[model samples]
Target: MNPHTLHAPRAPGDIRQHPTGAARLGPELLLAVAAERLRAARPELAARADLTTPQGLLDARAALTADEEGDPAGSPLVVAVIGRFDLPRWVAETCRFALALPREPAATWRRAFTRTVFLAGRPDNLTERFTFDHMAEDGSTAWAGPAPQETTTALRRLLKTLDASRELSAWSPVTVEVPGAPPEGAARPPVHRDLCIATARVTVSQLLVQVNHLLVEAVLDQLIAPGDRLTLRAVPRLTGPAVPFAALRVDADPRRAHQLRAYAGLTEEI
Candidate 1:
């Protein structure tokens, strides 16, 4: 299994996320915690791993880990960086090919279906190019396909009802509409092109910070419900507004589906 994928398991309801606002934990601690994960995987063998063979991967992981020991999950002096798993292809490519954009540079990641309007000076857009030394976790470039669900109507309703006037709101239309245009055909989507705009972008930095902050809530979900599970019934498809993403439609009852022992085993019960 991919070591990166061996993240802290999600607990139902007691979601544990990276804290936020004044509560945000230092990235050093996160690295320490991640390093702890490595320790768990190898026990006393962490120091013995072939750190030299893989070279940068081990170095990168170490740089992000508990370098000084003690409370790996909580510490002073952390390396805090912005970005997440769900990013524009351009951004991902920059990181994958360019060593995670060490110094900022300008770039744009467009959606296959619609125009992508990246606020001109975002960090992901402008960053130091790294040698494409890293491989995507799955060794694939294709974004994961949409989850199965009935989302179109609910999404339209949610969009129509969200109060965009508030400082913090959902379904906010970042773009304004233009004059008449022909309908464009839908095609396979890249990541940012097709996920719910669930994040709050107070700033590009804030966007990364808050999303990672949710890691605390994700952790809590697990702590609150030791064995129960949760599948984020996320809105699928394009990341921006004025763009429609797709979902799987099925007529199964959620509760009844849970009655099956398969409930524990099936993430698709929804």
Candidate 2:
């Protein structure tokens, strides 16, 4: 058996205990949360989308988590949606729904789908550039990247600064629309239109900070439930968000997706 696919018996309403394996906890947990929000926000679309099924969500997660030997992020399902539907609206709504979930599951859902978005629909557009080295007092140009521990610490610090229950506001991907002329084979009354391109660029550290802030808030709100087999208490001075967190954008590449992998040392095909 593949080491990464190790299995652990799960309890009722519980997903799994380990991060590895075919029964890894993140995928279905994320699906249950996101699906709940999507069903409420867009019942008509949600009714038709494959995301309504656990297997469908598993397939979507598989698309994002596939190894290098597998297909690129541009999975057939993603291509189908992007080509035939209003991709921007879908992505915006999905992100909105993700923020509405409890922080842990919400973050997992966002990260997974964000990877899918970067790999499949927006590979050439999303970019990450690390810049912490420049913050050194000596101003020497060294490649001192942000450490994961340091990023987490910074996030915790920033979380204290955010007010509880930050309102859910309009936060959409930075988009560029390119207009195209009518096709040569177009019949009468055909409409020429624009392509909606979306992208985001934020350092891993910044993402960590945002995630940590939301996690703190989730804990304060007692977001975890009895069905999740977890108990949490609301802490004084740390009362978390009563509302959803807004999505934010970070700096990225204008044309290609190369700089981000180098800055973050990411190995994913995305």
Would you estimate the TM-scores of all the predictions?
Answer: 0.20, 0.20
- Model 2 vs. true fold: TM: 0.20
- Report lDDT (CA) for all predictions: 0.25, 0.26
Model 2, 43-116: lDDT tens per residue? 55446558645555344334434531263322111110011113233322222222334454434323223221
Q: Give the per-residue lDDT of model 1 (tens digit) for 164-251.
A: 2222233432311111222354232112222232332233333232322222122222211122222221222112123221121111
Please give the lDDT score for candidate 1.
0.25
How many clashes in each structure?
Answer: 40, 4
Worst 10 residues of 2 by lDDT: 261-270
